[model samples]
Target: MRIYTRKGDDGTTGLYFGGRVAKDSALPTAYGTVDEAQAFIGLARAEAEPGSELDQLLVAIERDLWVLMADLATDETNRAKLVAGETLVTDAMVASLERRIDDLSARFTMPSEFVVPGGNRVAAALDVARTVVRRAERDSLAAAAPGSRVVAYLNRLSDLLWTMARWQEGDSLTARAVAPLAGEAEKGA
Candidate 1:
């Protein structure tokens, strides 16, 4: 099939269940940001060791984002057509992220202050992915339909990504001094 449909050349995009909207509309923006986040996650996955835990988690998260995108793409009028665990972003999806966050965060020393977002290649990439997820979360919140769980999922996802980056960097996170990890410097002792 030809990739260039040219259906969107007029600055409009099609929705999931028969409708169209401006290309720059909130729904498209939200889903587009989600797509961007998924791409960054893919980049981070590329840096991870083959079949490692981080690699596996990133792959799963990427799949989840596709479900989020589907949820975002569908208009409210077509809600009944969406299948939970497939096109719908369900409560369990958000809960899974929370569990992963707890699981991963338990393995790392939580920094008391903001992270520097760069330590090693993989960690840095994951940090970028985390920020992208944050942006996606904001966009999704603005566009999400009533009772939608997309925002909640993205919110937890960013937390998980942050924890994953710290886990990947390990002690290195404590060393990277973009702002000094917690109170280690003591400031002119």
Candidate 2:
């Protein structure tokens, strides 16, 4: 298995299930943007505190993104490989993200003005990741070419990231506004 297949030298590449398309094809763009998102998450993770929750969340998100890439990698013949990943980027994922955004918001300060994108290395890196995520969402939607659930997921994910950044910046969201913890109210009382 040589890495240099030279098949893509002519501005074309093979998909996951023996399908060939242009390098800039929609399928590639969709999955390729996912790859980009994962790379940015890696960078952000490296810059984040070693054991911070944000760091951990990014790790999980990156893992999910790999699954997403697999899902997006359909062959040229529309004969997809067994993707193994969650074929649907479900509403639950979106809800989970909203919960996370709320959790971070509860402990941070909300911002009204635009952010400068640099409170620390992690923050800066996260900002970069957020932008890339937005771009990925755009590209993914373009590739979807219709009302796609995955595209909607990406859009929400980007907003989640933006809110997460602000949350990291000390914008505190209320506990009630977020998902209620199992014993949080009891503890507070």
TM-score of every model?
0.92, 0.77
Root-mean-square deviation of Cα positions for candidate 1 versus the true structure, in angstroms: 2.9
| Local lDDT at 88 for model 2 | 38
Q: Candidate 2: TM-score?
A: 0.77
Per-residue accuracy of model 2 over 1-189 as CA lDDT, tens digit each: 787978889998776656678989887988898898889889978877788888889887887776666556655245233433364355676677778777766666676455666655666677787888888877776565343356766776777677766656553322224434669977887
lDDT, candidates in the order shown = 0.91, 0.69
How many clashes show up per model? 0, 9
The predictions' CA RMSDs to the true structure, in order, are 2.9, 10.6
Distance from true location, Cα of 130 in model 1, Å: 1.0
Indicate the TM-score of model 1: 0.92
User: Whole-model lDDT, candidate 1?
Assistant: 0.91
Cα lDDT over the full model 2: 0.69
